[model samples]
Target: MVDRPRKPSALATTPGLPPQPQVAFSADNSSVTATLPTGESVSVLLYGATVVSWKDKKGEEKLWLSEAARLDGSRPVRGGIPLVFPVFGTAPDHAQTKALPQHGFARSSRWEFLGKSTSESTPTPTTPAFAATATSAAGAVAAAAADMSVKLDFGLSSSGLSEDARAKWPYAFNAIYSVTLNTDSLTTNLVVTNDDDKSWECQVLMHTYLRVDDITTTTISGLQNATYTDKTTSPISSSTQSSPLLTISSETDRVYTPAGDSPASVPIVVSSDNKPKFTILRDNLSNVVVWNPWVEKAQGMADFEPKDGYKQMLCVEPGAVGTWQVLEPGDAFEGAQTIVLGGKTE
Candidate 1:
């Protein structure tokens, strides 16, 4: 009898590409770890392709995880960098009134592991081509990337999604999420290709939660000359803040946008006692969300796990979340951010 062959699935192994010694699959075969030769490393879960953790050469965790975060694929894990796509906050318009559970569904969906690479090539995105716009910045990431970094790619397509999720989203598209880890930094790139026949509008964000020593004493800068929407206020106040640093105290939830009145690269710095300063930089992504559940809000959260867990975590998310974008059929959107530890800590 002749053996029949299996058609290619998204996660199928690429021919001639063997696993690298620096990369390892989890014991239970759940997650993958990519470690740099210099000892910096990152681990990503297939579910949501969420970056679960990043450790420096010293083996200190830079990203935060909830004391109560469920890692068994039950729900969106509460920490790390969650990929938020299709929409950012609540449905922004009438077409998406059906969007429930806030922040859209991309974070809860599973992604296909496209495998790891030192480098990979992809057709440049036509929609929201940010690299062209970032030319003015002399040292932008597009200039070049170091060859020593570890790269991993994950994919998700409407064809592989559940009918229930498709019925709501209904847009035919393919997304590739690339994660790069170097000795000093980690970069996450989301490239989405629109496979539909018509145009559609959507929002994307990298909701990154950074672990700090203390939320109360942490100082955040690079957003001083920016405009922010105070989501914690009853009326949702909008104003420009000129101060260089915004300190967190109470239940803080603020969305800040570069006040340049045009698209511009922004850098956000989060620093606290005994914690290495983190510098988050991104272009094309315009808005930054700063949040800490605080005491009362932390106690009320069902997923926070540790009732007082808010004290150790602060979220400083960077993405194109403040404005909606349109993607023409066959086009794509690319946005990336890099976080690096800099300077001495207390």
Candidate 2:
């Protein structure tokens, strides 16, 4: 079982209404933050519904975000969870993806705030013609100390997309993203329904950036012995990880694809000095993309900023990248990843 910090419960001594999530605007009012009672909270932007920050009960960030990350809606946010959909990092058979944005329009395109699961917000996240049923949603977010979970859904569809985006990939679809926050872990669930007659293949990923004291000092487990395509190499060679503790000392980019008979829930352990800080459990996501732009590459990118910002963060993404997830007509696909905080033995 997962181990979380033993927090004192106040409900037993002081009786009151269960603290509802304060779904309010940030001080700047440009973004919204869901402040959970458990002291763990997540901030999101209405622009792309991009999750910008997720903090634990101690108010420490589990995710790594660039100091220069933009929130003006000009481009895809540089950090947090930049939703990658329809296509992932320019694949082979996706003809339309080449012409459109880098990781498909989902991240770049604006999404409508369909509101909360309760009546306070809108009923659903779709347009008048395509709102889906509640089955698209999973369990709600659990309080920092409470038993029940809190859930909020965001709607994005072909109809709600911009003209330029719709012209690029014409497929009727409803994408309902329900973000449920638990006491120890925050779950991101993506439910995609193909409303069109033709089937389509796509890739989706939560390009998650994790924060660390130093990138080079951390070792990532759970991927050892798995086959991976080394993108850092010229010809892109594939190899099996021999080391039980995979350490990153230089510029690294690799995609790990497990065997068909591998365990369904792969636990990727992130640790410092042999003590785990947190564990990322990926469900239905067989691939893990590990990347850190070390020196020269970090200087060239405008988003990385400060020239040496790569030392503080790492991207250990879980998604369907090696192969594609196909959705037939009227079919729905659900994929999720849960990040459970470790003992914090720092």
Question: Highest TM-score: which candidate?
Answer: 2
Per-model TM against the reference: 0.82, 0.83
Question: Highest lDDT: which candidate?
Answer: 1
- What is the C-alpha lDDT profile of model 1 across 1-346, one tens digit per residue? 7655875656874443333328888997668899864567899988888999999878999999987887778898899888888777786454852454567667878888888877422213352333553543322222222225688989999887777778888889999999999767889999989999998878889989898887878889778779889999988999887888788879888888876655347567787863448988886788888889899988887888688878888898888877778899998899988887874221
Task: State the TM-score for model 2.
Answer: 0.83
In candidate 2, position 13 carries an lDDT of 30
Put down candidate 2 lDDT per residue, 1-346, tens digits, no spaces. 7666896755553332345656777675566777666677888787777888888778988777777877888888887888889888875456646666778888887777667642112233453312433343221212113443456678899899989888878888999987777667777888899999998777888888887777767889887678999989999999998887888888899988754475337688888777787788877788888888889889888987666877877888888877777889999878888877774212
Give model 1 RMSD, 1 decimal: 9.8
RMSD (CA, Å), candidate 2 to true, equals 11.7
Candidate 1 ranges with C-alpha deviation above 4 Å: 1-21, 119-147, 261-263, 273-276, 343-346
Candidate 1 lands at a TM-score of 0.82
